[model samples]
Target: MTRDAGRPVATPSQTVGPFFHFGLTANAALGTLAKDGVRGERIGLRIRVLDRDGPVPDAMVEIYHADAEGQYGQAHFDGFGRLPTDGDGTCVFETIRPGAVSTRADGAQAPHVNVCLFARGLLRHVYTRIYFSGDAALDEDPLIALVPPARRSTLLASQPSGEPAVWEFTIRLQGEGETVFFAL
Candidate 1:
């Protein structure tokens, strides 16, 4: 007896890690409301925690910002929301563009969203602010310059989608692209 030569063959290989395919979960709270139905935008943030070896599933992400009109308050603004990344380690936030805030110093900060990251095994949560890449105001922003040149890139949010109004970014926990931490 002989086996058929046309039979499919099987090969063994290493399994792909979750980090490579991050953001594959559904967050109910972040879903959009409609008269007929509910739709949700996938929360896909490239989050990297500093000094951590791999993805932190328990990390809680929160973002606060104002609407397109630059209005933030109880009547117009909804408070912050908490979200956790899927096994792939990505969190999504349904937020609007924040208004430009004036710094204590001479210049003003560009319209930007604020991000807060909290995870297990960390003594304290990390605080970092994300800024738009092409905002003209960034050139003279004092806070943006406070970060060292080497680490400045990390603070920038990615515009992968190519929609200037909407933004995206990945936080590198280790290696290159690590976000800059603020003293406060």
Candidate 2:
């Protein structure tokens, strides 16, 4: 590539990854949050990443959120976790359910975990949120209200049958049933 006159030529864009496992995974608390004495209901968050074809095993999943009391950065609560997907395209985080976050004086945001997805073929990572399926606050969340009712389910993480403590969320990068990624 060469400069044209005084202006530099635009280069073609490239995908962000094939992430280097060592750099992203080194010395990281990969998927365990809620260490002992973190006051909240302990639960497992199971995340699956998929493309139009099938499961995506090479993706990295990260989540950060408020603690059980809607407070973040507490000494005992790390409030963050990151993990690479396994061959099954799944990663599980053992953490406590976050409490409802008060985002406004007149309303409260629903309890949710903020998620980021990093995978091959993406120009940059994408952001999303995972809301518990049955949370009553979901009906009133300002953010949730912004999403169309038909597409809102993509943001929900549902508990599997007989797995009361484990919630499963699937992220679809494209095609039908694609998960919604927020611009922010």
Candidate 3:
């Protein structure tokens, strides 16, 4: 008789947290921005975050950004713009591509979306920013550079489905590919 030579396989375990029960509600701030006067058409962004075990139904995901012109001034908007995730841990946003921002360095900042995470288990919110894929400006982005090169893909948004103009991205809370977090 021959003994099994394969390495022992470990089953993935699920981790539970307190912030998993929060429900997403539409906010006036986000609503107004969606209808803001921007030249370019608004695109829908769907974000899904899976818990360690699987998809977290009630995960609270929030996305913030400026109008089509990429203006986030107080006069243009009031209160922090936030959109929550749906029942499937998915959040949808109707907005336009953010305009370029000036960075500390000589180069300009790339267009991107800022993401904030608040789940059942965590007491405070985790801050993460998502970048666009194939953006020529991404090469010179200062914020994206902060993240490790190996993990940069996690923050880049992908368009798996939907129209050619529409953009989509899925986020994994923990495990193989996790979104990159910032200090602030």
TM-score winner: 2
Extract clashing residue pairs from model 2: none
- Tell me how many clashing residue pairs each candidate has: 5, 0, 6
Across residues 1-184, which tens digit of lDDT does each residue of candidate 3 receive?
Answer: 3235676656655453544444344463563355555455566676787767877666666676655555565465421455555667776666666766665577777877777777766556778777779989888888788778999998888776547656778778778887777767
> What is candidate 1's lDDT per residue for 1-184, written digit by digit as tens?
3345977666554332333224425555742211122122223334434334666655666666544444444454553555666555666555544556665575567766667766654456667787877778777777887777777777887666665444566665566566776767
Give per-residue lDDT, candidate 2, residue 95.
96
What residue runs in model 2 are displaced by over 4 Å at the alpha carbon?
Answer: 1-13, 26-28
C-alpha lDDT of residue 7 in model 2: 82
Residue 39 deviation, candidate 3, in Å?
2.7
Q: Residue 6 in model 2: shift from native, Å?
A: 17
**How do all the candidates rank in terms of lDDT, highest first?**
2, 3, 1
TM-score of each: 0.66, 0.90, 0.76
CA lDDT, every model vs. true structure: 0.58, 0.90, 0.68
Model 2 lDDT at residue 53: 82
lDDT of predicted model 2: 0.90
TM-score of candidate 3 relative to the true fold = 0.76
Model 3 CA lDDT for position 181: 74
> Candidate 2 or 3, higher lDDT?
2
